[model samples]
Target: MTGEVLWAPSAEGRQPHDRVVLVLDRGELRYRDQRKLQGIWVARGDDVGRIQGRQGPDALDIGAAELRDLLCRRRGELKPALMDQALVAGLGNLLVDEILWQARIDPRRAAASLTDAEHARLHRGLRRVLSVSVREGCVPQRPGWLTSVRARDDAACPRCGRSLERRQTGGRSSYACPHCQRPP
Candidate 1:
């Protein structure tokens, strides 16, 4: 229940300046960057109860069943819905992209439109991608991995060697293998 708070100031025009405070309990993370006043809530501790962020309901001390029920009610885009920390916690853009690719689901797919099979795929993919990424501390780039091209403007698909396409999605650069993730 006792932990230390870490603070970092934002640079000019950086808004809240990448400040994250970790609340630790018994040497495990209980809360992370609880900057609700500044509209930032990174993650919550597994043992913590009822977490509140600046955006409200950022994460409640709820069980897995509650979290599943909440996810089922979202009708928004699948990526953003998964990224909503208030709903699932501990997922971001890189994770989302990697999950979708592993699940073979398009990023633009509507959450409600996904079939049960696709949902299963998404869940499995999310877990797998996150588990490995967390161990490695963020997605590491392999020579031919898609992530290698993620930040390269003219990078091509590693699988097919075709030019990768980029678009502004959810206010971030979205890199996709056009051939592999064709529109439905």
Candidate 2:
């Protein structure tokens, strides 16, 4: 969440925040992290599998059935379960909140409490959100999207027009529309 990879026309264009810069034949690829939260680890062959074995299936690649099964196996609230990289990789607080909001699921609901249709909705939301985010190159703040107004003091649900609610879920801020995401 705190790291960025930027490309520059030349190595001389490196910024103060750039932690590493690869001088390519035509340009430079720079890794920048203001918080230094991400790191690089090199592994060879089987070692790579061993290193990544603890992480669950990637959010972008996991199938709907697999996601339902994974959630069903979790014993915690939905938000934390989704944020746990050991349970579902590639999802952070912001993405999980947005996904739940999109799925119209309550963040406080038990992880295993989703109905079959709810699971389907959740999976679809994940795919759609990630696809748009990947295309935009970031979690875009656009109209009709939760991210657009989530941080505003007077934010309202883009869909329902009801005031948005904010709370601390699993130690991270969560934004949801109370009218859309009713408590379980």
Candidate 3:
């Protein structure tokens, strides 16, 4: 076969018995004691599957409509709204911090308080940050990127360097440039 052989215990063995079941091209082998298949070669092929884009953490596929709906009705804090897996999928704590920083929205701001312009900015920020993160795997901390602050507990804001403040939001420690993102 062109695919690898993945093995599972036979029904009898799974229940409680010494009988062994083996599957081979010749046919099924049933032995009261044990059965072993010889010359059973599994092949690895290059055409296994096609590459797909990164799906969010919950593995729920999200489209534009669902994203808009989730954002519109979300009544929690902005950080929590972004962190909800069912709402957008694939969003993690780092992504939320980066998105809020990029959009200049305070983590504590209410989701309903976001203006149309701010919402647009947030949408753009999410796409931009997630795309880059998925491409490189995790948030990339380039020299100018804000993710540098995430690495250091005492790391100051890259933009203001006024001692980044860490706060708990949605059960996660959120780091923000106090000067850049003010509480709304």
Output the worst ten-in-a-row residue range by lDDT, candidate 3. 48-57
| TM-score of candidate 1 versus the correct structure, residues matched by position | 0.63
Candidate order by lDDT, highest to lowest?
A: 2, 3, 1
Best by lDDT: 2
Candidate 1 ranges beyond 4 A from true positions: 1-48, 52-72
Q: What digit string (tens of lDDT, one per residue) describes model 2 on residues 70-124?
A: 9999997998899888998889877887888999999889999999889999999
Model 2, position 125, has a per-residue lDDT of 97
Top TM-score model: 2
Model 3 regions more than 4 Å off = 1-68, 169-171
**Which scores greater on TM-score, model 1 or model 3?**
1
TM-score rank order: 2, 1, 3
Against the unseen true structure, what C-alpha lDDT does each candidate score? 0.61, 0.87, 0.65
How well is each residue in 25-120 modelled by candidate 1, as lDDT tens digits? Answer: 433222233233334434668523433432223222334344446667888777787777766766666777767776777777776677666767
